[model samples]
Target: MDPHNRRRHPTTTRLPYSLGCHACRRMKVKVLYPRPHYRHSLIGSRQCDEEKPQCVRCTKGGRMCPGYRDANQVVFRSVNTEFIPEAQNSHLRKTSKSGGLLIESISSTPLLTQPTERWEAKAIGHFLYNYSLAPTKDSPGYLGFLSDLLSKEPSNRQLKSGVLAAGYASLANITGLSHLKRSAEKHYGETLQSISMALTDPAEASSDTSLTAIILLQMYEVCYLREMWQSFHNDHSQAISDITLVPQDPHDKGLVELHRLRGNSPSRTAAADGILHIIHGRLHFNSVGGLHPSRIDAELAFEGLNISSSQDELWCIMREMSESCGKIRAIMSDPRRNMPESAIIQSFDRIFAAYLHLLRWEATQSLTRSYQSYKMFSREENDTHQETFPYKYHLFKHIAHGAMWIGFWCTTIYALQTLTRTSSLLDVQLLSRGWHQWDFNKRLRDAIGEICACVPYMMGDVDQLGLPMVGKEGKAIGSFFLLRGLYVAICVEELTDLQSSYILKTLLRIAHVRGIKLALRPRSRWFAQHGIAT
Candidate 1:
């Protein structure tokens, strides 16, 4: 009988030759079989293009296409891997006809031996690695409290689920991973359910974990949820209606309570303090000074924290300005109530006082003063008419300095707009001569210009500047700071139709790019009112 024609024993018969080159075969060899993408697999219809140097599949998949091996030298051999213990178990061993070992390749992609861990741990780690804003231990980022809280109460279901939701959502947003995105939505739903349960229990409702979970839910909605923008728009309209038409008491949860609930770490405490001030000053427009006992306490608090002096002064000024604005809003809301002219005059006096303080602060700041001079002297007639942001890109060496300048300009615009409205309410004879000295229109234009110039720096668009100014990792932090100032600039009645269009466009970019839904609220309203497509 011919040796070729003789039937071989079933156990000793060699498999048919693969279409793939040796390198492609070697990269994906498995005892069970090559996965579907490899050539001549029982499970797949794919076949490799046997190119001279290497197969097409390996090259296209970003795998190094090592040249084919000599068929004569082909031999079975054991290949060791640094895969995790579980992965090692998942792999199988097969004996060749020559009694040599055939080792399977676990994967074509290079991977470190990452241990199998809980999905919660992975999710939490992913979220912090990307979203943490804290540049240093001393100055905790906005999401720093999440770390502290999780460390203390690792099993808090509500907080854990919230963190998981945010982590998965952010990762999905960045990588476009459908499974992770679905996981995010699933965790978000679980978190909402957990929070609902927590709210019903009296002890859990006011817990820090619950509060932090609530904060995370807010952040998740702002960063991940697509429908949140429309929801925010609906709520914003209702909010406006409540503020302007209703006579509800100013919402104050009390500073004592906030101080009590503040986090343990300095970073957490500092973040909580800043948040307290922002909620009081911007959200409710309540007076921070009124809540505190004396000027010394506020000053001491500012000094103890990593806050900038310029911001400290500006906040002091803004607290008063916001209070004045709130009072004016309240008065305007109640046309039926007999509000005396003296009360209205008092509010105007406070506004004027804040305006003067703002001017003095600007003059005293070397950085702000130089920037102002540059913007004032650098513009050409053509540039002024073009409705573009004035001045070159100025780098902020310090976050505090950036905040200080942005806050100053924001406060200045608010003051000017307030004065314009207040002047209309007051008799012309009663208007202060000093209010007339500064051209409110020119001042607004200048302030808006300066604020616009700060956008790129704040957004980390100029990473070429070499400052760690809120890069991709700290987008939430940057967006948090940008929202209030940008909204204030956009809302100025003195803004030109051209300027309004430009600023609204900027807000739209921030909403979509930064993934901050709060931005959409103002942008949608502005665009709707202006008859522009949002």
Candidate 2:
């Protein structure tokens, strides 16, 4: 048979019809019969060339030939004759919709797929549990609104990712564990990636979920990273601007209220409607005799108030003052806003009156008595007394004192800034005139002392109160109180350079121990601006 001369046949075809040869019959194929070359073979041989339907010799021998099998028929070979049972093989079978067989191996499953989800759940769980504790007295609505966001379904991926990142970051702080810290970093990267994708879709970018995610990411930076705080600050400022352009939603009302109450610039629509309108309308550009009407009203509202005063009422007053101070600071810092001399004087007087109001409120017998009582409580409890007296009681007492201290400190700073911004002769003369014989230095020293008192209570070191030892707390301090205390310490003028440096360093150390990144930004700013060495 010539190899090149063998024609390719269709897969369905077989050799031409021929009588079966014994070999071809057994093989189920047509036998080839070619004319024998007498010179290439023995004349008596019965074997034909077997190249086609029948060889001439086969015909001469009167033998039948078998047909060839089609090309498409395929045979599979097994390595071993002992086959696995179908029951066992069922595990490898993937059922097809058409009732056909499909096979997949168990090894194809990814090893980390399940663990990744578990890690994500863990991080999210940590966030849900601790996020409520993050806000201060001034922003009580923060956690509530965040909780509301989390309750809704088809959860926002960006927001969830951001929360996970923050949660892991907080866990890193709580435990100081390296793996948790790495997880925080990993989730943070994921959050950024998600946010970047969300931003590409204008609708998603402006969604409430996106805004909340942005806020959470900022919070994470504020909690764990000192160096990133400024960047978060800048990013938040930009987000505030961007949020204004987004279409308003009813659900966003809480956010709007929070922004207004926190003294941040609220959306114009929010500012013009509801209780916000009433508050803004009442406070805007309204003053009398160098005092804000609201401040005067706040004072008058609390006339004859004592230590028995409703804690809620006192808190509300303090919050108002805080907001007012924030507004004043914002206005003073704005280069584009020019105020008339009369307005400036009024601003100065308003701040001065606010400070005085805080002092008067504090001077009440009830307040003084409460302060004394807290001091005694803190003093009575030492590290050894932990079994009998829980640290929470002491923490609560410290927080109460811290709240008052913060109120007074903020009011005083606002007054000081008012004077600094104006630097007017009237402002100078008003203070020099010795109105009620007020001593600014003494007042600042008293405020610093009050703040310093909180340290021992927080550190479980009440026994060393009168001693000059710097103590670290055995447990985490409330970030809110720590931040407020830091703010007061930084802004007050009475502390000597050495005293200020020590306080700042101790505060930073406590913050680090507690995983409090929020205070670091302002604290760092204070050091840089004042050229305070730490």
TM-score top scorer: 1
Q: Tens-digit lDDT track for model 2 on 84-190?
A: 23323554565666876675444432322334555566666656654443333332222435555666734677777788788778768767778878877877788
Worst 10 residues of 1 by lDDT: 288-297
Deviation (Å) of 78 in candidate 2: 42
> How good is model 1 by TM-score?
0.61
Query: Could you tell me the lDDT of residue 193 within candidate 1?
Result: 95
TM-score per candidate, chains pooled: 0.61, 0.47
What value of lDDT does candidate 2 attain over all alpha carbons?
0.49
lDDT of 2 at 157: 75
The models' CA-based lDDT, in order, is: 0.58, 0.49
